[model samples]
Target: MKTLQASRAPRLFPLRLSFRFPLAALAVMGVLFFSPAHAERLKELASIQGVRDNPLIGYGLMVGLDGTGDQTMQTPFTTQSLNNMLQQLGITIPQGVNMQLKNVAAVMVTATLPSFARPGQNIDVTVSSMGNAKSLRGGTLLMTPLKGIDGATYAVAQGNMVVGGAGASANGSKVQVNQLSSGRIPAGALVERTVEAAVGAEGTFAIELNRSDFGTTQRAVDAINRQFGAGTAEAIDARAIRVRAPEPQQRVGFLARLEDLEVTPTQASARVVVNARTGSVVMNQAVRVKDCAIAHGSLSVVINTEPVVSQPGAFSGGSTVAAQTSQISVNQGGGAIQMVRGGASLSDVVKGLNALGANPQDLVSILQAMKTAGALSAELEII
Candidate 1:
């Protein structure tokens, strides 16, 4: 019995050792399968060529303001536009009439004509005051013709301006919120003409990536081919792809299915965008860093001025005079040099920066210096 028990124990030990190898292999496979990068839909990553929006602009006038309109004396264009409009309505004012208009404001109307928009389709419009108007609140925009870059009128805009802000002034002291000079009107312009598109016109449609990347373009092509058939899609360049599609009538359904196909996008280039005015810092996942050191400090200067009155004694002949006294002081913050190890990932880079106890503005300065020193292996953009 003892011999059999010893033999069974030895066999069980080997079985346990055999299981470890498979468990280790699974752990490694799990790590590879759960990578941080995720698959993205083609529609979100690219746009179909010839499918875009057109910009429309026009000059217009706003009326019925509660004494917050443009000053006609300063803005001659406003008075001219009003006069021209009145004349068109068969009401001509005499020459040198010296009309003092207070409720009229000159404005520029703008809108975006979406792709495939048909005539009579209502689109939103934006009205911006072109003159020195205090506010556009409680004002109605006149009928204005909106023209595209081709110099053809495409739509007409007319509606009441919806101001986003309000203000009050008394004795030259005023308070305001948001913006009061510009406003938007929903469904304000009726499309007068259509901007033709040639989507899949010649049995081929082009796709343009939002960002140019050869690997991503190839992946997109591969995805389309897998869903449709081999040789159905071809990569034109890093930014565009050409695909053989169905006829114009069936093109919409084909594109609908193709856009839903998911493909793993290529890794993004390492980059850091900095907003100088807002002190904002944004970095993508691919950002990396080499070993570096940073030291930051701040210096403050203060100056104070006080008026001192010099008085003479009761019987003295000296005159009293006022003298100015000034005091100046400077304070320098303590600085420490910190060692930062090389970072292979974005999180590591963030941790390294956090270890230096630097604020956003300081981080911007440090990043710029690091980039100059070649420690940062990423593009830095400031806007």
Candidate 2:
């Protein structure tokens, strides 16, 4: 009919290009076989020893402070915490009446509590400036208490600080920005006390681990005995692990389903860190090395002084003098040897230390001369 429908539209365009090349190779083999890896959960890698965070502290008293407070006669503990809060409020003063408080200051506060935190819940304190105050901005904080580290008194704080920074000086030039002697109060304390925590009482629980490996604590005790079964968890060493739980009324739904399972941890060792004041370097994917050959070059000296004002010709009696001159210069550079090869990972030792083009402080002296010639295999640290 129209040349047989143009030969059946080129045979249905090769059967829709053979079903779009096997659905684009099954979407690239489902992204190279399901791609996952970085897993997590086990309650964000462990920590159940009575779930933590107590800290607390206290001391308080920050008052108004428009005059940048704290000079209460060279901070004699801000006039002895304002004569012990006016003798615990009975206010009897009148003795050596030397209270020249330009607006008070003496702070400290702090906070934390967290883990199950009950009593009245609030927590957020901070405060700071314990003496030379100079700037607690528009203060307030009075109530105080907070304690903990065994000194008892769980929380109390007080509020109104929030000083995110600001300063001024006048005749001596000054212009501050963020952190006018520390602040922050929001939800200023409260939690009165409750740190008991017997976790799962006698059904056994443990976990711990926030880093101590033994192959990530035996792969989190075989992913918690393969989701609770074979002897239901164990390990107890390279940072705890124990387990067995499930009775204190099913231990909070068995630790909320064993801290959402997931597992996969185990893979840290190789190290490399090196931040000696920001030349950074990091390395980790089990950092590897071995077959090396780097050569990187640099040298560079430079000097240049110059300062010659010696005019005496016009006067003849020689009177104007001042002379100094230096030049020096070295440079060096051009070395290039680079070979690298052996590197079982950490991106082949960062592509063989970026093929020796050095830089990060000359790749921290070529990875401390490839870890003093043993051809680096990891653990260098430096911090």
Candidate 3:
């Protein structure tokens, strides 16, 4: 079965704006772009259409390492695996045999199952050591079959691994650049089985948006209907659209025609995304702000430390004793409260924050508080 028919791939939200430090580009009224696109329900930029790829993963091993493989003694799995290989090669070690190999490591195999991947097609794979392998440099991945959750093997992988960086250690010191425990095997896997195709069927086909938005879905349906004639398409929800197509025999041709049609979809909802850990803020063009004033000030905190000495009491046969003590001090920072003017555009908001000279991380909090106060007109999401 073609994955294109029975889709196992899941969708994800497309894009988001940041609240911490959103790029400020003023969208003036009636600007050709800001204006309702001329091709209202039929334009490329306004529509979301594409066949997406899916993810597939498997666990396997990497061999031929340069003495950097997993310490087999510590990882019994590695030792056991080595024995199995020896036996496979027609070599037999006595019972309770032990091996000290330096070129093997148990690794996890991962690959992306392309949309509609066919059997015998080549796909790239990544090999990552699961055990405490010092490095995966100069290694080769053995034959590993990648399978789906259904335990059906879909691909067979094997190739030389390419580690992006190098590292070295000597005299209890080490230096490295980039990671070495993981490596990439270019076009390492051969598709053994294809995921069934499930999309294009009889006269009608269903299109699911990456994100569920009533406006976008309706626009998509309208655009499709306009191209093929009225009633050709219908919106089932903010996420799915059902379009009438040719009979079973013509489904493929119908899809080809459908993909090329342009649709000026309705604008996505206004939303701001904030990544607190990275101090990143993004805001979509659709976002706006309510008229409001902001007063931001920094409270300072200071600390001081000092050392002290103490003398011991006199005693008949005792030498003088000495002790040490420490002192600490604190101070709070102060700054003049600055007033931020009411803002209607992204530029205004950025200008206000720049005036505060607030760092990215701190700005994240400020934007969240603004949203909470109903001063910002957009959904705020933190990730």
The top-ranked prediction according to TM-score is 1
The candidates, ranked best first by TM-score, are: 1, 3, 2
Q: State how far residue 78 of model 3 sits from its true place (Å).
A: 1.4
The estimated TM-scores of all candidates read 0.86, 0.44, 0.80
lDDT of 3 by residue, 5-38 (tens): 6756433222122334333422122321233434
Poorest lDDT segment (10 consecutive residues) of candidate 3: 25-34
- Lowest summed lDDT over 10 consecutive residues: which window, candidate 2? 9-18
lDDT of 2 by residue, 1-383 (tens): 45544453211111111121122221122232222357789888888987888787878788887877888877787888788888889987888788788788888888788888889888787888978878988879889888887898988988788887777889999988887998788898888888878886877868898888788788878877877788988887998988877767678887888889887876667767677776766665666788766666889999999999978797578898899999999998947565677766554456556555556777777788889998998879797
Model 1 lDDT tens row, 221-283: 999999999999999999999999797778889999988989888888888888898767777
* Model 2: CA > 4 A from native: 1-45, 61-70, 73-84, 87-89, 92-129, 133-144, 147-192, 196-218, 221-244, 249-265, 269-271, 276-285, 290-295, 304-324, 341-360, 364-383
Worst 10 residues of 1 by lDDT: 9-18
Whose lDDT is higher: candidate 1's or candidate 3's? Answer: 1
Q: How many pairs of residues collide in model 2?
A: 0
Q: Whose lDDT is greatest here?
A: 1
**Candidate 3: what lDDT?**
0.71
